[model samples]
Target: MEYRRRTVLRAGTAGIAAAVAGCLGSNSTDDEGSIAGEELALATTTSTYDTGLLDEINAAFQERFGAQVAANAQGTGQAIESARNGNADVILVHARSQEDEFMRNGYGVNRRDLMFNDFVIVGPSDDPAGVSDTEQATAAFEAIADVQAMFVSRGDDSGTHTKEMVIWAEASSEPGGEWYQETGDGMGDTLMIADESNAYTLADRGTFLSMQDNLDLEILLQGPIEGGPELLANPYGIMAINPEIHPNVNYQLAMAYIGFVTSPEGQDVIGNYTSNGQQLFFPEALSDDPNFQQYVPDGWQPNSNGE
Candidate 1:
């Protein structure tokens, strides 16, 4: 929870260059010192950690490997920064562009596809903006802006926040008005704020499912459209901090985590874990099962009274 409290400093021109330099210069064992025990450092987005999926998987991982994992859950941007600063041994996050850049810069290695979920637009059940009927996510966002519907954004450069920005760009809308608000918080807290204020917000399906019973928002848009619009399709990836880049990193344990999450047993656990009778995440790295392929982003069919 302390990870939630740390503010992400503005990554300005000088800050970014310095962060990169730090990553490059800190690879020496003398700089990072040595680990004292069999431990792993995991830095990741709040979505996965907040949904309780990581805790389940981590328990199994601990049981099998006999290693203590210190999970530092934060926004994807901050998690990447933590890796750049040599604070995390491995990372499991969903923001694709950032993840790609992290690897390109030589901070991480052995990136593996772990699982896939989708983002959804959720709002008051009355559908004030009529976003529920929009065929595309962009259209829904446009409508919300057009009607000046209250909207809450994570505003923390999180994975969900990144996806929301992408949708806004696709809609060609720059959403800033009295109706728009930023929580600068995680998914669960953002959802609660949206619920209390009757505002529209984008969320990953896993967190939405996990906290659905406690909120009043309804899913308005989901992914895997009739065509292949990929904005809503959220896929997670796992990677170890390049041990060569930071010698204190537990590369073997990081690899074990990568192996376990992509392994058959790990995949089984992912495929079976559900929230409110719906699967939270689907194992995608090595799975070709039809059951995992079946899903509706809307959370439910239309014209159903909360069935």
Candidate 2:
């Protein structure tokens, strides 16, 4: 679906001061009630920030509410931890199991499905493991392992890293050793490492598309779309930090942000975000299929065995 892409302001040192000045209005003084005081903190995954999605959303949110958003972009694990520690008011993350655990543990509330894209294994264009033709992710991983092909891993406990571990477990008893190298960095950096080393690495499709022009790696295995347990469906969700746990958190502001994101307007924006003219997130909650969530909770499911 096509929607207007919001203009992103360059919020460097000068732009930030100007934005703050604009947000504070004419009555605000230099010493009293600065724009920073009115800002809401949003802790989110790096993929969202690196792709420039958060900047667009933050600009819109600030314009609509006169309340700026201070975003901390990190791995999903770190984002969740920030929310838990009351360092952030809300969280946008991709790891469903971890998100559920956060809610169940009373660290967050109002967990809602947001948006999604699938993971893809990227490797050298020559396809040393011969995974370019394989439909099964396990088979592809096994082939890579059999040849001891160099593989790069985020190894940072990010959502992508978690999915990679699951795929490796399905393919073999172990996924770490000499052939598997861990970078402990975000998606963009990991992709660069993979490209420079001519190794394979799992990455979110959004990040892959955003960085495609700068990288030499090619998509080897896309997440399964069918086949039962073997499919790796990556879903993203938003959760508000429990106000009861963090009394200092901006609860109402956080809810407003959630409402904006899940609303039809916000979902429309998410559905339309694209890089290189290709849409990044697919909205699945509006689908008529009852098992849509079961298959692709956010938007995509792994393509297991080419099914």
TM-score of 1: 0.81
Clashing pairs in 1: 222-297
Instruction: Compose the digit string of candidate 2's lDDT tens values, residues 115-209.
Output: 87888878999999898778877888888888889999998888888788787778764676788899989998999999999999888888888
**TM-score list, all predictions:** 0.81, 0.79
- Clashing residue pair totals per candidate (backbone < 3 A): 1, 8
**What stretches of model 1 exceed 4 Å from their correct place?**
1-37, 225-229, 287-307
Candidate 2: segments with Cα more than 4 A from true spot:
1-37, 224-230, 284-307
Q: Write the per-residue lDDT of candidate 1 for residues 81-152, one digit (tens) a residue.
A: 988887787899998788877886899887877888888889999999998788788999999999899999
Clashing pairs in 2: 223-302, 223-303, 224-301, 224-302, 224-303, 224-304, 225-302, 225-303
- Scored against the true structure, residue 278 in model 1 reaches a CA lDDT of 87
Q: How much is 22 displaced in model 2, in angstroms?
A: 21
